[model samples]
Target: MVLVFLMVNAYRELTPIVISGRTIPLKTIRKAVFIFCFALTLILISIFLILFNQGNESSFLKVLFEVTSAFGTVGLTTGIAPHLSTFAGLVIILIMFIGRVGPLTMMVSFGFRKTRAIPQYPEEDIAVG
Candidate 1:
């Protein structure tokens, strides 16, 4: 379902949609992708670290499966969830909520609003390593 939403958003972004003499910009697509990737990375890393600290003795594959399952809200497990720590369980719940509601929807519900007018600032290049 998430993938379907992403694909649909991407298609809408690629194909221009004009209504009432104005082209509608699908800016949510970029925001959604960024939010999804950022959340996925953060969740994966945090879960991996938590599992590592718990000394579960489970292989990386099993941990990955559990995290992905939670993120996808698939309710599938590798029998390791029962042994996980409380903190890990909370993290799984967070991921499950994020998966079910979607990162974009969660952000929007949390008062993330898009402004009609964006203020542009002058660009300046700074020294970089």
Candidate 2:
């Protein structure tokens, strides 16, 4: 998704473009990239939280699987789900919630933003390809 945003921005910035047909807006790509990054960060944080708490109780791969399952909501585990600490369980729950509703959308629904009305300038035609 990040690559998509980069490529679209680059394409839009090219010289002597022609608008042959409808094209996706860069804003959508930017939002997708943002969501992808936020989900990646949340996954990493959740995995580390479980790993640090689990210690040598399980293999790293097992911890990773558990974390993935939690975020994926697949309801599968390597027999370690029963032994998760309270903190670890909470972390998994957080991951599940974000996974279900997405990080950015969740933040918006949670009132983490204030919409602003930006006045639009008069439309003008521009060449694109």
Candidate 3:
């Protein structure tokens, strides 16, 4: 569910962007991606809360520790990484991929349009500190 949301939102953000062709505003794409990533973080937090509630035998801190480690794709945890269920591990893997590649690359693979480069003005010197 979260993966799907991320994929779709990323597509929406990156699809219409073109440097040579002015189709959609770049600012619009940036804002949408920002909001989508924010929402994804919130969704992951909500999932963590639910998992902790269901696995009440574990301490809240432990649950948070494991969840954070999993979602961050850090592969680090308080000795709980080996204990996760197969389904949970798969979720972690998917989340890790998403976190690593991010929404931009995901969208670029499918939604982007390719075109030949256009010539641009030559660079001018500017003072540097």
Best by TM-score: 2
What is the Å distance of residue 71 in model 2 from its true position? 1.2
Please report, in order, the local distance difference test score of every candidate based on alpha carbons: 0.74, 0.75, 0.60
In model 1, which regions exceed 4 Å deviation?
1-28, 114-129
Candidates 1 and 2 compared by lDDT, better number = 2
lDDT tens per residue, model 3, 31-66: 576647754674466457546545754556765666
Candidate 3 yields a Cα-based lDDT of: 0.60
Where does candidate 2 stray beyond 4 Å?
1-22, 115-129
Better candidate number, 1 or 3, judged by TM-score? 1
Report lDDT (Cα) of residue 57, candidate 3. Answer: 47
Q: Cα RMSD for candidate 1? A: 6.4
Per-residue alpha-carbon lDDT of candidate 2 for residues 1-45, written as tens digits (9 for 90 to 100)? 445546665777752222355454667656777777777788888
What digit string (tens of lDDT, one per residue) describes model 1 on residues 67-127?
8888888889999888888887787788888888887777778875666988999999687
